[model samples]
Target: MSDLILHHYPMSPFAEKIRAVLGYKQLAYQSVLMPRVMPKPELQALTGGYRRAPVLQIGADVYCDTALICDVLEHRASTPTLYPPAVKGATRIIAQWADTSLFWAAMAYNLSPKGAAALFAGTPEAVAKAFVQDRAAMAVGMTRLRPGDATAAYRSYLRRLANMLSDQPYLLGDAPSLADFSAYHPLWFSRVINPVMADILDATPGLLPWMDSIAAFGHGRPAELSPLDAIAVAAANTPAPLADEPFVDEHGIPLGSRVTVTPEIFGHEATEGELLAATRMHYTLRRQDERAGTLHVHFPRIGYVLRKAEG
Candidate 1:
């Protein structure tokens, strides 16, 4: 087995989600810090064009999206399962809700005027302005929840989470499952990155204790690895084996054509490469950037759209 390599930056919320999963699985992984903005040359080499944070690298196989990353880790080790057998369906549903709907609402609330001031307090005006511009660009075409609306939603969700915990130690049962990790990351962002916005959490005291429970699982030992080193690792080794699933044609786009995958809402950047595989669950693009030899960038089929790039 190759080393578990993660390409992420500290400030990324989705990255935190995957990091917590790694800790839960007790998996040892190496860390590669990728740039938050463009010119991520090393990452471009491995992923072809996908620039999202916290891409998991197992040898040459680069897995994109926290949802798929979690699945990969779950398959790699099953002792503390993310999806317990009895609640797998329910778990996935809740996990998806947490990652997308709940996440956006929390982030909107967390980055409100007061929260933004706190987050970018010491930074230069230009730095703060540029950061806002970059994120606003990424959220193209999507309706954002206003701060007031987001505050109401965040409060409701936190209270609901508190209700779920009133009965069990975890969301579903005794041990932590996928649902717990998914919910934790967003709230983690509010508490850790923008505590000014997290005051609403006070309404749900039960959640505070649960957050402590989840935080106790430290990120498993992470060896310092640079982006160049991670790309080299992929160039030197074979990507993890792909499952033999048939590709389903949904977009009138078929395999062997050039395609690009981009996030639908936030992080709307596109990753371009040769469309190598489009299974029911994932999209694999074969692209060779000079820094990293031929490497594959894989993204889950959800929360992203795949289309042939305009010539």
Candidate 2:
């Protein structure tokens, strides 16, 4: 099997989710540290325009979005399985909620005046400005929870998580699953990203111990690989075989149509390209990045929109 190459930065919460999974599985993978901001020519090569942090690259196929990435990883390493058969559906639903609602609430509160200062501290003023602008664009249509609201929601969620932990070591059971990873990242940002602001965790004690348990599974042995080297590997190797799942029509756009896909909110702007493949879980677009040559830009079906271009 071709090496699993992860493109991510240190501070990305979603990236932490993947890293923790890797750690839990004790999987060996190639690490390609990418820029948190733009000018990521190599990433643009792999993803086209979906510049979300922590993309997984496998041979010539790149998987975008952590949800899809988790699925891909589960297939690769089944031990310490993320999805348990008994509660797969329930676990997934919980993960989805944690990723979005819980994530936003925690982040909004974390980025309040004090936390933002702590996060971008010592960084250049322009860096902070650019980050602010970039995030603002991502939040175009959605009304974000104000800091006060976020604090309340975050506290409530933390208590709820603590309650879940009160009975068992992990959220659902004795072992950590998808629910644990999904739930951990947001709190991770709160506690690890800015511990000064992490006083919020004091309200719910069980969450703190759970955080330590999850954190103990550090990202497993990561062999350093340059972006150029990684790209060459992809260009040289054949894409892994995908399951023969027929394309189910959901968007009303037929096969071979030119289309665009974009997040429904937060990074809401669209990326235009030729529609290549629309599977049950993802949409792939063939796009030409000036340096990356022709690449398939993929996006998860959830939290995004797909539309055909008007002639």
- Clashing residue pairs in candidate 1 are 61-239
* Lowest summed lDDT window (length 10), candidate 1: 287-296
Instruction: For residue 251, give model 2's deviation from the true position in Å.
Output: 1.8
> Candidate 2, which segments miss by more than 4 Å at Cα?
288-290
Q: What lDDT score is found at residue 14 in candidate 1? A: 87
Question: Over the stretch 147-175, how does candidate 2's per-residue lDDT look in tens digits?
Answer: 99999999999988889999899999988
The models' CA-based lDDT, in order, is 0.85, 0.85
Task: For candidate 2, give the lDDT of residue 156.
Answer: 92
State candidate 1's TM-score.
Answer: 0.95
What is the alpha-carbon lDDT of model 1 when measured against the actual structure? 0.85
